[model samples]
Target: MLEKLLPIQKNLNEQPQNPDSSPEESNTSPNLLESFKDDFFESYSFVNKATLILKLFILILPGVFFFMLALNDALDRKIMALEDDKNVLTDELFVYPDVQAIHTSVVLREQILKQVNEKEHYAPAMLDSIIKSLPEGVSIKNEMVQGKTASLILLSPGPLNVASFITNVLKDDFAQEVSILSANLVMTQNIYEIELVVRYR
Candidate 1:
């Protein structure tokens, strides 16, 4: 048996190797697959990506929890401040009327009215009363009120009678100091017009 195997091995070793044989016919396909194996592993590697995502989530979770806690604490403090303010306002409401701030507006209005009555240079009310007391057919041409002085122009049909009328008005008890500004004769209407100014004491 050893002698027969020796001859068979010697005959296998004596076979000639062909240098012109194509690599594709030999072991070409497996060599290409071996080179691409490293690239395939690099292209489809999910473990590193999964580990990176897990690390990012770990970093963000603490920040999210911290933000939530801080926001809740801030809202609690704000609510506490609002409750304190509400309690203070509720307590002040009962004692507000006795604080001397009430009735100040009424007192101020009374003071203003008193001051207006005491002032010497206010005669609009008196002038209105005087206008209402004038007799018929006695139309006033001009009426002016300034400070405490009231002036008016009296027009009548009888010419040159305005001066006498003014003199009579000055002697009346209701009339104060009177001054005749002018007495003129209008020829077209044949009337006597006189301007008189009266002062209210």
Candidate 2:
């Protein structure tokens, strides 16, 4: 009986697994799934693209944040510099400590110029006053003011009229010193020419 069973097992072991089958053709489900996976997913798949985009975001966000911080720092520095410059300019233009400094020649020069301009601007009134004060047959030829001094050239019919004019100038509060620069007769015009310079009071 052992001999019969041994021969039967030997026969079973010697038989082929399948007569018309091969290893390559086995498990069609697993092979088809592997092939489908290879075709659907390539080198640049959705998973790879998502990872690349995430890496780029991680790199660029820090760079942008640092860049904005640096820009804000630069703007703050610029604003501080501007404030310093503004303070310096304000001190130079508006701050005055000493009375003498305010009355310095440069400052006085501007004031004097402004005063003289104002005086000249009211020249019509001055001329009107002069015309009203003039004696008969006495007329002013030229008149001008230089700082605190005023000059007048007048034509009169006689010396008495010139004397009258000098008395009128002295009576007024406009002059402190009256100087007779020239007093002469114009023979052709039959008139007396008088040039006077007066210091303002």
Candidate 3:
């Protein structure tokens, strides 16, 4: 046993005193750390590239979508405004006929009033002339005065009386032109009907 122990002791004395200190572990540690650093840098670079792309996508995509959405909203609002204007125009068009009618009636009324005012001054003299020239047997049935023209419907007992009435009207100084529109014998009333149109100077 003592002889076996002596060899073992000799082998033990040839070895290093510190069991934890190893040259191989010291040499391999730096290489492993370097490899780990290289791997970390590669991964970090890839991650940074991915992050940049993601950030760009995040920034631009939402902005593009928002712009498109805003444009659509603006177009929609414009269409609605146009529709509202069209409806208003349509409503006005619907009411236009009544407005036009009222305007036309007012114009016609004004024209009638203007004509009446213009002829008022000559009405008394024309009536006086007509009355004085009328024959004794001729009776006026209807008389219409318009502008410078007068229409008279006379009822006479005979053709001679009607002829005499027309002759008397033609001799009047106030008349510029006189025309016998119609002369008809009314068998029912046994009278001659004379229609005359006269124009004043």
Per-candidate local distance difference test: 0.71, 0.76, 0.81
Query: For candidate 3, lDDT tens digit of each residue in 44-161?
Result: 7888988999999999999999999999999999999999999999998997768888999999999999997875466677777777788788899999877678899989898788
The worst-scoring run of ten residues by lDDT in candidate 1 lies at: 22-31
Select the stronger candidate by TM-score from 1 and 3.
1
TM-score of each candidate structure, all chains considered together: 0.42, 0.38, 0.40
Best by TM-score: 1
TM-score of 1: 0.42
Regions of model 3 farther than 4 Å from truth? 1-120
| Total colliding residue pairs, candidate 3 | 0
Better of 1 and 3 by lDDT: 3
For candidate 2, which ten residues in a row score worst on lDDT?
A: 23-32
How many residue pairs collide in each prediction?
A: 0, 0, 0
lDDT ranking from best candidate downward: 3, 2, 1
On TM-score, the stronger of 2 and 3 is 3
Cα lDDT tens digits for candidate 2, 1-201: 688788757755654566676644443343456544444346568778888999999999999999999999999999999999999997887656575675797788999899977763434544454566688889889989656667899999998998877777667676577788998899999998999886655
